[model samples]
Target chain A: MKTFLFILAGIISGILGGMGMGGGTLLIPMLTIFFTVPQNIAQSINLVAFIPMSIVVTIINIKGKMIEKKGLLKMIIPAIFTAVLASLAVGRTKNAVLQKSYGVFLIVTGVFFIALTTIKLVKKRKAEKENEK
Target chain B: MSKKKETILYIIIGLVAGFVNGIWGGGGGIFVVPLLVYLMKYEERKAHATAIVIILPLCIVSAITYILQGIYNFPLTIKVGLGVVGGGIVGAFLLKKLSNTVLSYIFYTVMVAAGLRILLM
Candidate 1:
């Protein structure tokens, strides 16, 4: 039963991720909250699980010429540096602190998305009004 | 944006996204997508695709770190990973057929609720 739940959680998160939504955000919360998995372990699971899933997508995207290569290295180099440092820091941090921080991150992400959606809607409405004038 | 300024901005985006993703184990793509779209003038679809390119390496690094730290559950990861791979294929198919506006709204609402729940847990 527990294993089933884990797979279900993975599938749901994966589906969202494959659709271009951030799956790890939801996956971590689901595992920690429902399954009582430790925060760190759940996070590790997300990182690992993302590997195979992303490889497949990245290959398809590359083949379709969907990826923008220009300026990519500039972003990737700095990101890789910081990511390494941060992952090391995770080992020394307390689980509770990480959990709380993640909670805050999720709220901020949610609000940000909602705001973006609202802005798009308002712009569309204004454009329609102008068109009808 | 001038070439130098644009380059600096890209580095900043990378720094922040990497930090967030590494600390949290994922979510760098969220930051990358928007920054690429609104700031760097990338089209939405291209930004999404490019984000995967950026995040793939980050996840690889972070996952390796976690494994080295002995924080991984191998069996659990494998089981969940299989599901994720299968679901990813389905999701890719769905992306072609479905409009994301409604889905986005629902997803955002759930994220907020889940965030609150996790905070109070």
Candidate 2:
């Protein structure tokens, strides 16, 4: 049962991760709430799980020639360094605070993405209407 | 933007996105894709692909840090990792068929649902 649950979690998060939205947003909550894992461990597991998904998706993307080489080159180094530093900081944060802060972050990001996408959709619709006319 | 200016912008996006990934685990792509598409003028598919690539190192470093701190659950992570590998392949293939609009709608719906659930419940 436990293994099954883990597989389920993996599949759910994997799809999101592969899609480039980060699987942890859903995986962390699923772990904490359903599986009763602690916040820190859940987050850690999410990171670990991301490794394989990232690798696979990256490989696929590479094969499909989907990446923007210039953007990848420009961002890779800075991204690594900042990730290392922030990860170290997370290692020291309290679980309760991390959980609350993570929740709030999700809410803000969710609303932001929803609003951005909605506006884009509306703009696209207007453009289509104009074209049709 | 000029080449030099664009490079700087990408760096900025990387720093912010990387920090978020490090702190949280799975949301770096949120910042990455948007910044790449809007700010850097990348195609949607290219942004998504590049974002995944950028996330790889971030996840690796963060996972290592968590391991060093002795916070990881190895068995669970490994199990899920196996599943995600297959899932990732599936999602990657799906990208060819899916439109950017469809993808964005899915992302918005999932993000909002997950956020509201976590925040309210």
Interface RMSD of each: 0.8, 1.8
Q: Flag regions of model 1 displaced more than 4 Å.
A: A128-133
Error of 1 at A131 (Å): 4.7
lDDT by residue for model 2 (A31-93), tens: 877787888888888888877777777777788898778767678789888888988888899
lDDT of 1 by residue, B1-121 (tens): 7999999999999999899999999999988999999999998888998998999999999899988998898898888898899888888778889988889989988898888998898
Angstrom error of the Cα, residue B107, model 2: value is: 5.0
- DockQ, in order, for the candidates? 0.86, 0.68
lDDT of 1 by residue, A1-133 (tens): 9888889999999999998988778999998999888999999999999989999998988998999998899999999999999999999999999999999999999999999988988898999999999
Candidate 1 docking quality: incorrect, acceptable, medium or high: high
Backbone clashes, each candidate:
0, 1
Pairs clashing within candidate 1: none
lDDT (tens digit, per residue) of candidate 2 on B1-121: 7888987898899899889988886688878888888887889778888888888888888889878988888888888888777777776666566666666667657666666666665
